[model samples]
Target: MIKRLCFWLRADRLGPDIPITHLMLYFPALMRMICSKRFNGFGEGSEFRPGAYADNCSSITIGKNVAVRPGTMLFAEKGDGVPGRIIIEDDVLLGPGIHFYCPNHSYKDASRPIPEQGYFYKGDIVVRRGAWIGAKSVILSGVEIGEHAVVGAGSIVTKSVEPFTVVAGNPARLIKRLR
Candidate 1:
C-alpha cells in the first residue's frame, strides 16, 4: 500500500494507466511547477498547482501555502492599461473551475452597442489570508474577500466578503459567520 502511494506521488513515473486527475491528486510537485511556469507567470511555494494562462500584472501577489486547483482562470483586462492584479494571501484554497475577472463592462450605457459596451470598467481582486473559495465560483473584479472567509460553490462573488464569514449563491450573500 505504501509503495503504491509513493508511485502515485511521483509524476515522472505516472503514466497513461493513471488518469490526469489522479496524477494531480497525488503529485503536488508537478502541479507546483506547472503553475510557476505556465500559469500566473510567476508563483511561489507549494501553494499553487498551476496551468496555462496570462498574468501580466505585478498586482498578482500570492502568499505561502495557497493552493489553486485545476481549471482556475485569473485575468486582468486589456482596457485597464495596467492589468488588474490579484492578491491571494497565505493559506488560501481556491477550488476547481474558479474564474476571476479583474474587469467588467459598462452595461449601464443602454444606448451603446454591446460590443462598444466592452469599454467600461476594471477592478482588482484581493483574497485575504486563510480564505477558501469553493469550486466553480466566479469572483468578479474589484472584490475583496476578507481573511478566513469561505465562499460557497458556484457562487458569484460581486462584493467584498467580510472576515470569517461564509457566503454562497449568485452575487454572494452572507450564509453565516465562521466560528
Candidate 2:
C-alpha cells in the first residue's frame, strides 16, 4: 500500500483544487505537510498556500522562507533523474496566480496542428533570493528571475531578468534598474 500512502500524502491532482472551508483553520498547516512530502525540498518556514498547483513535485524546490501564494501554478517537467528544474530561492515573494511553466510545446511545423507538434523541454526556471513577482505573472520555460528583481503585475516573462532590476509587460521589458 505504499503507492496508496504516497498518493494520499501528495494528492497531487485533487489536493490543490480543494478549497478551504471556513472552519478549517489549519488548512495551511496541512498543505505545508503535504508539500513537504511531495516536493523535492520544501524549505523551513516556507508557506505553500491552498489553491497553489504543482505537478511532478520532485522537480521543484523551494528555499527557506519563501511564500507561494494561492492560485500559483508550478508546472515542472518530469524528472529525468534530474531535479531542481524549478527552484525558488530563499526570501522570495511570489504573488497570486503566478504561473511557472517549464515545458514548451513545439510549434515550428506549420503543416501540423500545435498539439500534434508535441512538447519540448527547456532549461530551468529559477527565482533567485529576494525577488518579488507580482500578481498574475507568467514565467515561461528557461527564464530566471535574478536576485532582488521585481516583476510587475500581469507580466509575461519569456527571458531572464537581471539582478536588482524591474521588469514588466507581455515579454517583460526592463522598467528600470534598482542597482
The candidate that achieves the highest TM-score relative to the unseen native structure:
2
CA lDDT scores, all candidates in order: 0.69, 0.80
Q: How close is candidate 2 to the true structure, as a TM-score?
A: 0.85
lDDT of 2 by residue, 1-179 (tens): 77765655555432344443111237767656666777888899898766677767777899999877778888887334333279999999888999988887889999999888777767899999999999999999889899999999999999999999999999899999997
- Positional deviation of 97 in candidate 1, in angstroms? 0.6
Best by lDDT: 2
| TM-score for each model | 0.71, 0.85
Return the lDDT, model 2, position 121.
Answer: 68
Instruction: Output candidate 2 Cα RMSD.
Output: 3.5
Per residue, candidate 1 scores C-alpha lDDT tens digits across 57-174 of 2446667776656667766553545566777877888888888888776677788776676644446788988899999999988799999999999999999999999999988999
